[model samples]
Target: MIRIVIVDDEVFVRAGFSALLSLADDIEVVGQAGDGAEALSVVRQTVPDVVLMDVNMAPRNGLEATLQIVKLPEAPRVLIMTSASPDNTAWQAFATGAHGFMHKAATPAQIIGAIRMVAVGGTATTPEVMKRLIDENNLRNPRHVAQARSRIDLLSGRHRDIILLVGRGYPNARIARELSMSENTVKSYVSRALEKLGVDNRTQAALLVRDSGLLDETLANESRVL
Candidate 1:
Protein backbone atom coordinates (compact mmCIF):
# COMPACT_ATOMS: atom_id res chain seq x y z
CA MET A 1 0.00 0.00 0.00
CA ILE A 2 1.05 3.61 -0.55
CA ARG A 3 1.58 5.04 2.92
CA ILE A 4 0.55 8.70 3.38
CA VAL A 5 0.70 11.29 6.15
CA ILE A 6 -1.79 14.16 6.24
CA VAL A 7 -0.69 17.56 7.59
CA ASP A 8 -3.18 20.36 8.04
CA ASP A 9 -3.93 22.85 10.80
CA GLU A 10 -7.60 22.14 10.46
CA VAL A 11 -8.82 19.05 12.23
CA PHE A 12 -11.75 18.58 9.87
CA VAL A 13 -9.58 18.82 6.79
CA ARG A 14 -7.21 16.27 8.17
CA ALA A 15 -10.00 13.89 9.15
CA GLY A 16 -11.82 14.38 5.87
CA PHE A 17 -8.81 13.60 3.73
CA SER A 18 -7.93 10.62 5.83
CA ALA A 19 -11.43 9.22 5.47
CA LEU A 20 -11.49 9.88 1.75
CA LEU A 21 -8.11 8.34 1.14
CA SER A 22 -8.95 5.28 3.20
CA LEU A 23 -11.39 4.26 0.47
CA ALA A 24 -8.54 3.67 -1.93
CA ASP A 25 -7.37 0.11 -1.78
CA ASP A 26 -3.82 1.04 -2.73
CA ILE A 27 -3.44 3.91 -0.24
CA GLU A 28 -3.12 3.93 3.56
CA VAL A 29 -3.34 6.93 5.88
CA VAL A 30 -0.43 6.36 8.19
CA GLY A 31 -0.30 9.59 10.20
CA GLN A 32 -1.55 13.18 10.63
CA ALA A 33 -0.09 16.50 11.82
CA GLY A 34 -1.43 20.02 12.48
CA ASP A 35 1.59 22.02 11.38
CA GLY A 36 5.03 21.79 9.87
CA ALA A 37 6.74 21.11 13.20
CA GLU A 38 4.37 18.32 14.06
CA ALA A 39 4.53 17.09 10.51
CA LEU A 40 8.27 16.69 10.78
CA SER A 41 7.91 14.52 13.84
CA VAL A 42 5.13 12.44 12.28
CA VAL A 43 7.09 12.02 9.06
CA ARG A 44 10.16 10.76 10.91
CA GLN A 45 8.05 8.29 12.82
CA THR A 46 5.86 7.07 9.97
CA VAL A 47 8.41 7.18 7.15
CA PRO A 48 5.48 7.50 4.80
CA ASP A 49 5.67 7.28 1.02
CA VAL A 50 3.73 10.53 0.55
CA VAL A 51 2.83 13.63 2.58
CA LEU A 52 -0.27 15.73 1.86
CA MET A 53 0.43 19.09 3.47
CA ASP A 54 -1.40 22.39 3.67
CA VAL A 55 0.57 25.35 2.39
CA ASN A 56 -0.66 27.65 5.12
CA MET A 57 -0.20 26.65 8.75
CA ALA A 58 0.56 28.31 12.04
CA PRO A 59 3.97 28.26 13.82
CA ARG A 60 5.57 26.47 10.87
CA ASN A 61 4.15 26.46 7.36
CA GLY A 62 4.26 23.75 4.72
CA LEU A 63 6.98 25.47 2.68
CA GLU A 64 9.29 25.61 5.68
CA ALA A 65 8.39 22.05 6.54
CA THR A 66 8.96 20.95 2.97
CA LEU A 67 12.38 22.59 2.87
CA GLN A 68 13.39 20.43 5.80
CA ILE A 69 11.41 17.34 4.82
CA VAL A 70 13.01 16.95 1.39
CA LYS A 71 16.42 17.00 3.05
CA LEU A 72 15.57 14.05 5.23
CA PRO A 73 17.39 10.86 4.35
CA GLU A 74 14.97 9.05 2.06
CA ALA A 75 12.39 11.85 2.29
CA PRO A 76 8.77 11.25 1.50
CA ARG A 77 7.08 12.93 -1.47
CA VAL A 78 5.48 16.27 -0.38
CA LEU A 79 2.32 17.53 -2.08
CA ILE A 80 1.40 21.08 -1.06
CA MET A 81 -2.29 21.83 -0.77
CA THR A 82 -3.54 25.39 -0.99
CA SER A 83 -6.81 27.26 -1.10
CA ALA A 84 -5.12 30.17 -2.84
CA SER A 85 -4.44 30.28 -6.55
CA PRO A 86 -0.96 29.64 -7.86
CA ASP A 87 1.15 32.66 -6.98
CA ASN A 88 4.51 33.74 -5.61
CA THR A 89 3.89 31.63 -2.52
CA ALA A 90 3.33 28.58 -4.70
CA TRP A 91 6.52 29.31 -6.57
CA GLN A 92 8.39 29.63 -3.28
CA ALA A 93 7.01 26.29 -2.13
CA PHE A 94 8.12 24.59 -5.36
CA ALA A 95 11.54 26.19 -5.22
CA THR A 96 11.81 25.12 -1.60
CA GLY A 97 11.50 21.47 -2.77
CA ALA A 98 7.86 20.45 -2.82
CA HIS A 99 7.25 17.54 -5.18
CA GLY A 100 3.75 18.66 -6.13
CA PHE A 101 1.02 21.31 -5.70
CA MET A 102 -2.75 21.06 -5.73
CA HIS A 103 -5.58 23.47 -5.06
CA LYS A 104 -7.72 22.61 -2.09
CA ALA A 105 -10.68 22.48 -4.44
CA ALA A 106 -9.25 19.58 -6.40
CA THR A 107 -11.48 16.66 -7.04
CA PRO A 108 -10.91 13.46 -5.16
CA ALA A 109 -9.61 11.87 -8.35
CA GLN A 110 -7.09 14.65 -8.89
CA ILE A 111 -5.86 14.42 -5.30
CA ILE A 112 -5.46 10.65 -5.50
CA GLY A 113 -3.71 10.83 -8.85
CA ALA A 114 -1.34 13.57 -7.63
CA ILE A 115 -0.27 11.47 -4.65
CA ARG A 116 0.35 8.49 -6.91
CA MET A 117 2.26 10.62 -9.42
CA VAL A 118 4.66 12.11 -6.88
CA ALA A 119 5.10 8.75 -5.16
CA VAL A 120 6.56 7.32 -8.35
CA GLY A 121 9.17 10.08 -8.84
CA GLY A 122 6.94 12.37 -10.85
CA THR A 123 5.95 16.03 -10.21
CA ALA A 124 2.37 17.20 -9.88
CA THR A 125 1.33 20.81 -10.57
CA THR A 126 -0.95 22.54 -12.99
CA PRO A 127 0.53 23.96 -16.17
CA GLU A 128 -0.30 27.50 -15.13
CA VAL A 129 1.49 27.11 -11.82
CA MET A 130 4.53 25.66 -13.51
CA LYS A 131 4.64 28.44 -16.04
CA ARG A 132 4.42 31.08 -13.35
CA LEU A 133 7.15 29.38 -11.38
CA ILE A 134 9.51 29.38 -14.32
CA ASP A 135 8.76 32.92 -15.40
CA GLU A 136 9.09 34.45 -11.95
CA ASN A 137 12.22 32.55 -11.01
CA ASN A 138 13.88 33.35 -14.32
CA LEU A 139 13.75 37.03 -13.46
CA ARG A 140 15.35 36.62 -10.03
CA ASN A 141 18.71 34.83 -10.33
CA PRO A 142 21.30 35.38 -13.05
CA ARG A 143 24.37 34.43 -11.02
CA HIS A 144 22.78 31.27 -9.64
CA VAL A 145 21.65 30.45 -13.15
CA ALA A 146 25.22 30.65 -14.38
CA GLN A 147 26.41 28.42 -11.57
CA ALA A 148 23.68 25.86 -12.31
CA ARG A 149 24.64 25.76 -15.98
CA SER A 150 28.31 25.27 -15.12
CA ARG A 151 27.52 22.33 -12.87
CA ILE A 152 25.22 20.80 -15.49
CA ASP A 153 27.96 21.18 -18.11
CA LEU A 154 30.12 18.71 -16.17
CA LEU A 155 27.76 15.82 -16.95
CA SER A 156 28.20 13.45 -19.90
CA GLY A 157 26.16 14.19 -23.01
CA ARG A 158 23.74 11.33 -22.26
CA HIS A 159 23.25 12.44 -18.66
CA ARG A 160 22.65 16.01 -19.78
CA ASP A 161 20.06 14.84 -22.30
CA ILE A 162 18.19 12.88 -19.64
CA ILE A 163 18.27 15.80 -17.20
CA LEU A 164 17.06 18.26 -19.79
CA LEU A 165 14.15 15.97 -20.55
CA VAL A 166 13.47 15.80 -16.84
CA GLY A 167 13.38 19.62 -16.77
CA ARG A 168 10.72 19.44 -19.46
CA GLY A 169 8.65 17.44 -16.97
CA TYR A 170 8.74 14.14 -18.86
CA PRO A 171 8.51 10.99 -16.80
CA ASN A 172 11.00 8.13 -17.13
CA ALA A 173 8.79 6.21 -19.57
CA ARG A 174 8.44 9.14 -21.96
CA ILE A 175 12.07 10.02 -21.53
CA ALA A 176 12.99 6.41 -22.36
CA ARG A 177 10.91 6.45 -25.54
CA GLU A 178 12.34 9.79 -26.65
CA LEU A 179 15.92 8.82 -25.90
CA SER A 180 15.50 5.24 -27.21
CA MET A 181 16.51 3.76 -23.86
CA SER A 182 14.68 1.42 -21.50
CA GLU A 183 12.74 2.83 -18.55
CA ASN A 184 15.16 1.27 -16.09
CA THR A 185 18.04 2.92 -17.90
CA VAL A 186 16.27 6.25 -17.71
CA LYS A 187 15.82 5.86 -13.96
CA SER A 188 19.49 5.05 -13.50
CA TYR A 189 20.49 8.06 -15.55
CA VAL A 190 18.21 10.28 -13.50
CA SER A 191 19.60 8.99 -10.23
CA ARG A 192 23.18 9.54 -11.28
CA ALA A 193 22.37 12.94 -12.71
CA LEU A 194 20.76 13.98 -9.42
CA GLU A 195 23.91 12.90 -7.59
CA LYS A 196 26.16 14.87 -9.93
CA LEU A 197 23.84 17.88 -9.76
CA GLY A 198 23.72 17.58 -5.95
CA VAL A 199 19.93 17.93 -5.90
CA ASP A 200 17.52 15.83 -3.92
CA ASN A 201 14.85 15.31 -6.57
CA ARG A 202 13.74 15.90 -10.16
CA THR A 203 11.93 19.14 -9.31
CA GLN A 204 15.14 20.82 -8.14
CA ALA A 205 17.03 19.54 -11.15
CA ALA A 206 14.31 20.82 -13.44
CA LEU A 207 14.42 24.22 -11.76
CA LEU A 208 18.15 24.40 -12.26
CA VAL A 209 17.79 23.46 -15.90
CA ARG A 210 15.12 26.09 -16.41
CA ASP A 211 16.95 28.84 -14.52
CA SER A 212 20.00 28.15 -16.65
CA GLY A 213 17.95 28.58 -19.85
CA LEU A 214 18.88 25.05 -20.98
CA LEU A 215 15.33 23.89 -21.53
CA ASP A 216 15.14 25.65 -24.88
CA GLU A 217 18.38 24.12 -26.10
CA THR A 218 17.35 20.71 -24.82
CA LEU A 219 14.03 20.91 -26.66
CA ALA A 220 15.72 21.90 -29.90
CA ASN A 221 18.10 18.95 -29.65
CA GLU A 222 15.25 16.62 -28.80
CA SER A 223 13.36 17.78 -31.90
CA ARG A 224 16.31 16.87 -34.12
CA VAL A 225 16.59 13.45 -32.45
CA LEU A 226 12.88 12.78 -32.95
Candidate 2:
Protein backbone atom coordinates (compact mmCIF):
# COMPACT_ATOMS: atom_id res chain seq x y z
CA MET A 1 0.00 0.00 0.00
CA ILE A 2 1.09 3.57 -0.62
CA ARG A 3 0.95 5.38 2.69
CA ILE A 4 0.21 9.11 2.63
CA VAL A 5 -0.10 12.16 4.89
CA ILE A 6 -2.27 15.10 3.92
CA VAL A 7 -1.29 18.50 5.32
CA ASP A 8 -3.40 21.57 4.76
CA ASP A 9 -4.52 24.47 6.95
CA GLU A 10 -8.14 23.75 6.05
CA VAL A 11 -9.94 21.00 7.91
CA PHE A 12 -12.26 20.37 5.00
CA VAL A 13 -9.39 19.95 2.58
CA ARG A 14 -7.67 17.45 4.77
CA ALA A 15 -10.85 15.48 5.35
CA GLY A 16 -11.93 15.65 1.75
CA PHE A 17 -8.63 14.41 0.39
CA SER A 18 -8.43 11.68 2.95
CA ALA A 19 -11.92 10.45 2.08
CA LEU A 20 -11.24 10.56 -1.64
CA LEU A 21 -7.89 8.80 -1.41
CA SER A 22 -9.36 6.13 0.81
CA LEU A 23 -11.46 4.98 -2.12
CA ALA A 24 -8.32 3.78 -3.84
CA ASP A 25 -7.33 0.29 -2.74
CA ASP A 26 -3.62 0.89 -3.27
CA ILE A 27 -3.52 4.06 -1.21
CA GLU A 28 -3.97 4.57 2.52
CA VAL A 29 -4.44 7.95 4.19
CA VAL A 30 -2.11 7.35 7.11
CA GLY A 31 -2.30 10.80 8.67
CA GLN A 32 -3.57 14.37 8.37
CA ALA A 33 -2.66 17.79 9.81
CA GLY A 34 -4.01 21.34 9.76
CA ASP A 35 -0.71 23.18 9.55
CA GLY A 36 2.95 22.75 8.65
CA ALA A 37 4.06 22.52 12.29
CA GLU A 38 1.51 19.81 12.95
CA ALA A 39 2.50 18.18 9.68
CA LEU A 40 6.03 17.57 10.90
CA SER A 41 4.76 15.76 13.95
CA VAL A 42 2.31 13.65 11.96
CA VAL A 43 4.94 12.72 9.37
CA ARG A 44 7.35 11.77 12.08
CA GLN A 45 4.78 9.46 13.59
CA THR A 46 3.52 7.96 10.34
CA VAL A 47 6.62 7.91 8.12
CA PRO A 48 4.33 7.99 5.10
CA ASP A 49 5.39 7.21 1.54
CA VAL A 50 4.10 10.53 0.26
CA VAL A 51 3.14 13.87 1.75
CA LEU A 52 0.50 16.08 0.16
CA MET A 53 1.31 19.51 1.60
CA ASP A 54 -0.30 22.89 1.24
CA VAL A 55 1.86 25.89 0.37
CA ASN A 56 0.23 28.18 2.90
CA MET A 57 -0.24 27.69 6.63
CA ALA A 58 0.05 29.63 9.86
CA PRO A 59 3.09 29.57 12.25
CA ARG A 60 5.08 27.77 9.55
CA ASN A 61 4.31 27.61 5.83
CA GLY A 62 4.66 24.56 3.59
CA LEU A 63 7.88 25.78 1.96
CA GLU A 64 9.57 26.17 5.34
CA ALA A 65 8.23 22.79 6.37
CA THR A 66 9.42 21.30 3.09
CA LEU A 67 12.93 22.58 3.69
CA GLN A 68 12.93 20.54 6.89
CA ILE A 69 10.95 17.54 5.68
CA VAL A 70 13.33 16.79 2.81
CA LYS A 71 16.29 16.84 5.18
CA LEU A 72 14.98 13.94 7.23
CA PRO A 73 16.77 10.63 6.75
CA GLU A 74 14.52 8.49 4.52
CA ALA A 75 12.17 11.41 3.95
CA PRO A 76 8.82 10.89 2.30
CA ARG A 77 8.27 12.34 -1.15
CA VAL A 78 6.51 15.72 -0.87
CA LEU A 79 3.86 16.83 -3.35
CA ILE A 80 2.88 20.43 -2.65
CA MET A 81 -0.81 21.21 -3.04
CA THR A 82 -1.20 24.93 -3.60
CA SER A 83 -4.25 27.20 -3.82
CA ALA A 84 -2.12 30.24 -4.66
CA SER A 85 -0.60 31.19 -8.01
CA PRO A 86 1.63 28.39 -9.27
CA ASP A 87 4.31 30.58 -10.88
CA ASN A 88 5.65 31.77 -7.56
CA THR A 89 5.25 28.49 -5.68
CA ALA A 90 6.14 25.75 -8.15
CA TRP A 91 9.74 26.86 -8.47
CA GLN A 92 10.09 26.84 -4.70
CA ALA A 93 8.66 23.36 -4.51
CA PHE A 94 11.17 21.85 -7.00
CA ALA A 95 14.12 23.91 -5.74
CA THR A 96 13.47 22.55 -2.26
CA GLY A 97 13.44 18.93 -3.59
CA ALA A 98 9.72 18.39 -3.32
CA HIS A 99 8.60 15.75 -5.82
CA GLY A 100 5.79 17.75 -7.36
CA PHE A 101 3.14 20.53 -7.16
CA MET A 102 -0.53 20.40 -8.05
CA HIS A 103 -3.19 23.08 -7.90
CA LYS A 104 -5.75 22.41 -5.18
CA ALA A 105 -8.40 22.48 -7.89
CA ALA A 106 -6.92 19.37 -9.51
CA THR A 107 -9.36 16.55 -9.92
CA PRO A 108 -9.28 13.63 -7.54
CA ALA A 109 -7.82 11.41 -10.25
CA GLN A 110 -4.97 13.81 -10.87
CA ILE A 111 -4.30 14.06 -7.16
CA ILE A 112 -4.26 10.30 -6.70
CA GLY A 113 -2.07 9.75 -9.74
CA ALA A 114 0.40 12.37 -8.55
CA ILE A 115 0.70 10.75 -5.16
CA ARG A 116 1.22 7.31 -6.65
CA MET A 117 3.80 8.53 -9.14
CA VAL A 118 5.72 10.45 -6.53
CA ALA A 119 5.70 7.47 -4.23
CA VAL A 120 7.56 5.53 -6.92
CA GLY A 121 10.21 8.27 -7.25
CA GLY A 122 8.67 9.78 -10.36
CA THR A 123 7.99 13.50 -10.81
CA ALA A 124 4.57 15.00 -11.45
CA THR A 125 4.15 18.55 -12.78
CA THR A 126 1.80 20.04 -15.32
CA PRO A 127 3.13 21.94 -18.33
CA GLU A 128 1.81 25.19 -16.95
CA VAL A 129 3.62 24.63 -13.68
CA MET A 130 6.82 23.85 -15.60
CA LYS A 131 6.59 27.17 -17.42
CA ARG A 132 5.94 28.95 -14.16
CA LEU A 133 9.01 27.38 -12.56
CA ILE A 134 11.24 28.54 -15.38
CA ASP A 135 9.83 32.07 -15.41
CA GLU A 136 10.06 32.53 -11.66
CA ASN A 137 13.71 31.42 -11.53
CA ASN A 138 14.49 34.92 -12.82
CA LEU A 139 13.42 36.33 -9.45
CA ARG A 140 15.92 34.20 -7.51
CA ASN A 141 19.25 35.40 -6.09
CA PRO A 142 22.08 36.58 -8.34
CA ARG A 143 24.38 33.90 -6.96
CA HIS A 144 21.96 31.16 -7.96
CA VAL A 145 21.53 32.81 -11.35
CA ALA A 146 25.28 32.83 -11.91
CA GLN A 147 25.63 29.22 -10.85
CA ALA A 148 22.85 28.07 -13.17
CA ARG A 149 24.40 30.04 -16.04
CA SER A 150 27.84 28.59 -15.42
CA ARG A 151 26.46 25.04 -15.65
CA ILE A 152 24.52 25.84 -18.81
CA ASP A 153 27.69 27.22 -20.38
CA LEU A 154 29.05 23.66 -20.42
CA LEU A 155 26.74 22.73 -23.32
CA SER A 156 27.42 23.12 -27.04
CA GLY A 157 25.55 25.86 -28.95
CA ARG A 158 22.99 23.41 -30.33
CA HIS A 159 22.49 21.81 -26.91
CA ARG A 160 22.00 25.25 -25.41
CA ASP A 161 19.31 26.05 -28.03
CA ILE A 162 17.42 22.86 -27.20
CA ILE A 163 17.52 23.55 -23.46
CA LEU A 164 16.29 27.11 -23.92
CA LEU A 165 13.23 25.71 -25.69
CA VAL A 166 12.92 23.26 -22.82
CA GLY A 167 13.00 26.22 -20.42
CA ARG A 168 9.92 27.46 -22.30
CA GLY A 169 8.30 24.05 -21.61
CA TYR A 170 8.23 22.90 -25.22
CA PRO A 171 7.72 19.21 -25.81
CA ASN A 172 10.15 17.24 -28.00
CA ALA A 173 7.80 17.20 -31.01
CA ARG A 174 7.21 20.93 -30.86
CA ILE A 175 10.89 21.66 -30.36
CA ALA A 176 11.80 19.43 -33.29
CA ARG A 177 9.34 21.13 -35.61
CA GLU A 178 10.34 24.61 -34.51
CA LEU A 179 14.02 23.93 -34.98
CA SER A 180 13.55 21.90 -38.20
CA MET A 181 15.05 18.76 -36.71
CA SER A 182 13.75 15.22 -36.36
CA GLU A 183 12.21 14.18 -33.04
CA ASN A 184 14.91 11.54 -32.51
CA THR A 185 17.63 14.11 -33.04
CA VAL A 186 15.98 16.45 -30.55
CA LYS A 187 15.78 13.62 -28.04
CA SER A 188 19.52 12.95 -28.36
CA TYR A 189 20.27 16.63 -27.85
CA VAL A 190 17.98 16.78 -24.83
CA SER A 191 19.70 13.79 -23.24
CA ARG A 192 23.16 15.26 -23.70
CA ALA A 193 22.00 18.67 -22.52
CA LEU A 194 20.49 17.23 -19.35
CA GLU A 195 23.82 15.49 -18.57
CA LYS A 196 25.85 18.64 -19.19
CA LEU A 197 23.52 20.67 -16.97
CA GLY A 198 23.62 17.97 -14.25
CA VAL A 199 19.85 17.78 -13.73
CA ASP A 200 17.78 14.64 -13.45
CA ASN A 201 14.79 15.92 -15.43
CA ARG A 202 13.58 18.48 -17.93
CA THR A 203 12.02 20.68 -15.25
CA GLN A 204 15.32 21.07 -13.44
CA ALA A 205 17.12 21.76 -16.70
CA ALA A 206 14.55 24.41 -17.57
CA LEU A 207 14.91 26.03 -14.16
CA LEU A 208 18.67 26.11 -14.61
CA VAL A 209 18.29 27.76 -18.01
CA ARG A 210 15.93 30.41 -16.69
CA ASP A 211 18.03 31.09 -13.60
CA SER A 212 21.07 31.44 -15.87
CA GLY A 213 19.44 34.41 -17.60
CA LEU A 214 20.98 32.99 -20.78
CA LEU A 215 18.42 34.51 -23.11
CA ASP A 216 18.86 37.99 -21.71
CA GLU A 217 22.64 37.64 -21.57
CA THR A 218 22.90 36.43 -25.16
CA LEU A 219 20.73 39.25 -26.45
CA ALA A 220 22.89 41.82 -24.68
CA ASN A 221 26.04 40.31 -26.13
CA GLU A 222 24.56 40.38 -29.65
CA SER A 223 23.49 43.97 -29.23
CA ARG A 224 26.95 44.96 -28.08
CA VAL A 225 28.51 43.49 -31.24
CA LEU A 226 26.12 45.35 -33.53
> Best candidate, TM-score-wise?
1
Instruction: Give the Cα-based TM-score of candidate 1 against the true structure.
Output: 0.86
- Candidate 2's displacement at residue 25, Å, is 1.4
CA lDDT, candidate 1, residue 55 = 85
Clashes of 2: 0
User: Model 2 — which ten-residue stretch has the worst lDDT?
Assistant: 130-139
lDDT of 1 by residue, 1-226 (tens): 8999999999999999998898789999999999999999999999999999998898999999999999999799899999887777776777888878988888898889889888877789876676787678658577887888898897888999899888876789889999899999999999999999998888889878887888866667779999
Per-residue error (Å), model 2, residue 143: 8.8
Candidate 1 regions with alpha-carbon error over 4 angstroms: 134-145, 182-184, 220-226
What is candidate 2's lDDT per residue for 158-208, written digit by digit as tens? Answer: 898898887755767778988999999999999889887777666567667
